[model samples]
Target: MVETSKVVVFQVGNEEYAIPIRFVISIEKVEGITPIPHLPDYMNGIFKVRGELIPVIDFERVLYQRPSNINELTKIIVIHTNELSLGVIVKDAKEIIDIPPEKIKQLGLIAYGKTSYFTGVANLDSRIITLIDPLKMVQSLDGIKQIQDFMAAEVNT
Candidate 1:
């Protein structure tokens, strides 16, 4: 039997990106993000979902070094890993697509310098989507340790 990864595709700027569906909690409408102080520019703030506080980050800023322009189509892709839970702001949540292992190409060494989180690219003939490992992306962020500790404490209290 062959294994195909199901991923959630989302828009950031003009490109489409994908994350493994297993990590996604939900697709939320952009709302009620309470800005906090002293966070990295990429860290938008924190928000509550079912009483759980999850730190939010801007996908565009993390990728392009510019904040995302929020509009009606904007959304938050809530995902969680063993380390922490987060809400990533995206221009739009596109669709879920299945990517076969054969269709995914690993990133080259040169591309790894900055986008270490980019696991591969899915070639679908007409278009390609960059595949991201959410855990790696979140871990690579500056000040993530403090954010993880804060989230852990929030969960405990």
Candidate 2:
């Protein structure tokens, strides 16, 4: 028996990226975010959702090394992995898709360094979506442990 992976697809720049639906908590509009200092530039800041503060990271900054082109269509994709809940800002939240195992291919070695989080690429006809492991993505970042610790303390308080 084979199982298909359900993913939430979202736009970042001209490319499309997907994260498994299991990690997604919610998709929210960009209402407001309070900027925090001394964090990485990609770390946008913290935002409130349901009385809980979630650290926001710009997907564009993480991918393209620039600020996200925030607009009315921009959204924050809340994802929880390894006990940490983070909000990633994206150009837009597209839709959920299911990719069969046969359609997924492992990325080449050239994409292994900075993009180690990319588990595979799914080709659904003409659409090519990069699949990312949210856990690995978060773990690959430097100083994310500090943010995780901060979040833990916030939760305890």
How would you encode candidate 1's per-residue C-alpha lDDT over 100-123 as one tens digit per residue? 999999878426656788999999
Model 2 pairs in collision? none
TM-score of 1: 0.94
What TM-score would each prediction reach against the true structure? 0.94, 0.94
The reply for model 1, stretches above 4 Å from the true place, is 110-113
lDDT of candidate model 1 versus the reference? 0.91
Tens digits of lDDT, candidate 2, 1-157: 6899999999999999999999999999987798888888899889998989999999999999989978999999999998588999999999998889999999894266778999998898889999999998898877898888877787899
